[model samples]
Target: MANDFDTIKKNANSFIIEIHKFIRENFQVSIGDQKKYLDSVTKDSVKTGQAKLGSFIISVSDVLLDSMIIIVYTFLFLIYKEHFKLFLAKLIKKENHPALMDILSQIKVSINNYIVSLIIEMIVVAVLTSLGLWIIGIKYFILLGLITGILNLIPYIGITIAGIITVLASLTGSGEISVILGILIVNIIVQFIDNNLLVPLIINSKVEINAFVSIMGIIVGGAAAGISGMFLAIPLLAILKIIFDRIESLEPWGYLMGNHVPRKFAWRVRRTKTQE
Candidate 1:
């Protein structure tokens, strides 16, 4: 019995030692592998961050340069406005000068009206947005509303970005799903009213552009010159429409771009009657 007990004690001690030995061997290898992985990840993250920073700096520099150029050109144009008119007059016949001047005046008035209407729309949108956010108990509602108003100038994508920003801001505070939902609902309702009512009454009335042309212009402008292009698209299209309408050969194109919708079969019946 003594001999059997001794053998059992020796076997149990050996089993424990073997388990400890196995753990010790594997633990060192696991720790070394984990350290290597962490080091690699840290190095990669630093490289990626540096690349992003460099790209961001370059973009900001380009934007600043563009802004400075635009400011300089605006100042020059304001200072030499009559000189530009004279140059345009010189490009055409003397008899056509009056017509050309009339076109220029029309263009100036249209652009002014469009800009003023946009400002009014912005103010309206800002007030509505602030009121909505305030009602939802959102933090920094005024600032967010102002941002939404500014972004709203960018056309279709602007409102979407505003919604995302508002949702994110709400998340930072309460982080509640209900707050996020409330923010979204408010934005949607405001956007709906702005699009259906305010835009038609204010912007569309001034610009006289069809929805299809406006959307296409924004898309093409965005693809060509980014955000600035999108913002300028409507005014530019309006200007083009004015020019096209003045030119006899291009009147059809001006009509095509305009918001005027005729009866479905009116044109066809008119053509048949003319033939008869």
Candidate 2:
């Protein structure tokens, strides 16, 4: 019995050592690409100058203002859909991008797997938010659930704006602080699921963007076209990377955008016969 116990201990130690060694090797391999990503971001740091923290604060304020304005316009369009449709038709006609449209369509199909996954995730978010709202005794819980589910289509900003509007609407109707708090709590829970789980799964489907480039894209796009631009920037960058990968002229740009250079060989993981 003592001999058996000693052998077991020795095997466990070997197992642990092998696992650690494998992990260390993988870490060293990934570190090369990590350094390249860092270098790329550092090079772009100069261009991101002047637009700092204060700029983000200002951007937040502008986003809030724009969301509220959108709410107003939404109500207006509800009353006059035909007029809004005419205006939108004129706008799209004036700014046509057939090439861009074709590219985006192809890219969307390429990422269809990720898109379907996102829809499943939004369904989960809807269920949770709806349950929470119902528990909190919100009268329009179903309506709020639908809105929240739709807003989940937009990352980050849309969720917050939708939550705020729902809470404010609740306040206006019920005039109860507890109701507002309940709404806030439910929204927080939904956002927690979104940020921690759904986002990591969906966003990480592609190569991860560096943190600094993401912020810079938000800043630059927001400055150029407000809320729409901020929401569009990340996907636009990803799409650009996809296009660059296809076009030889743009291969360098694709390399610059990506976190990792494509490696031709798959590194094999081997286990000792004793482990097998």
Candidate 3:
């Protein structure tokens, strides 16, 4: 019995030592391989980051160059505004000069009003969105609201993007589902007010564009030039509408783009003898 006990003790000790040896050997090998992998990853990441930064710099430079060119062109146009007006007048007969002048004046007024109204709309949206987000306990509510207001200028797509950003920003805070829901509700309410009240009174009244045409224009513009195209679509359409309405030959096309409902489809209450 004593011999058996001694043999069992020796076997147990050997097993423990073997395990310790195995762990020591494999641990060193694992650490070496891991270090190599980390080094490789670091080198690759640096190269990738450099490439990304280079691309970003090129894109920014191009944008800046284009913006500068536009500013220069605008300055030149302002300096020689009367010359351009005379140039346009020269294109038509002297008899049509007054009409052309009238058209140009209308265009100027429409464009100016549209721009002013747009700024007002942006301010209203930003304030309302910020207030709602703040009330809901969202962090960075002001920044998010400002972003939303700017993006809202893009028509249907802008508000959707703003909502997505607001929700994501909310996630960084409480990350609660209720908070997400609150964000959605706020966006919906704001959009409702903007579309129904603000747009009708401020923008649509000045532009006089129908919803169908506006939506189609936005879609086509987005497809052609992405976000910039979408942003310019409405104003361009409005301008086209103005031109079309002024020209006798293009009146029908202008009517097609306008929000005027035909008399046949108009709702009216017939007068009854008692009511009369």
- Please give the CA lDDT of all the candidate structures: 0.79, 0.66, 0.78
lDDT of 2: 0.66
Residue-wise lDDT of candidate 1 within 1-276, one digit each (tens)?
A: 233445445544554455455555877545456557768998889979899989877865655454455467668878999998889888999998887977898889888989898999999998999999999898779988998997787666668778877765654455444666789888888899898888778987898888789879989987887666767788899989998989899999999999885876788888899999
lDDT of 3 by residue, 195-222 (tens): 8888878887788888789778989986
C-alpha lDDT of residue 44 in model 3 = 79
TM-score of 1: 0.67
* Better lDDT candidate (1, 3): 1
- lDDT leader: 1
Candidate 1: minimum summed lDDT over ten consecutive residues — where?
1-10
Considering lDDT, which of the candidate structures 2 and 3 is the better prediction for this target? Answer: 3
Q: How accurate is candidate 1 locally (lDDT)?
A: 0.79
Model 2 poorest 10 in a row by lDDT: 264-273
- For model 2, how does the per-residue alpha-carbon lDDT over 1-276 read when each residue is reduced to its tens digit? 233455445544554455455555876635456557768987898557556756767867877676676567557856985675456456555444454456556666545554565577778788888889889887667777877987776556768767865764454345444666788889988888776777556653443444456567778887787776766576667667777876678888777766652453322223343356
Better of 1 and 2 by lDDT: 1
Which prediction has the highest TM-score against the true structure? Answer: 1
Clashes of each: 0, 0, 0
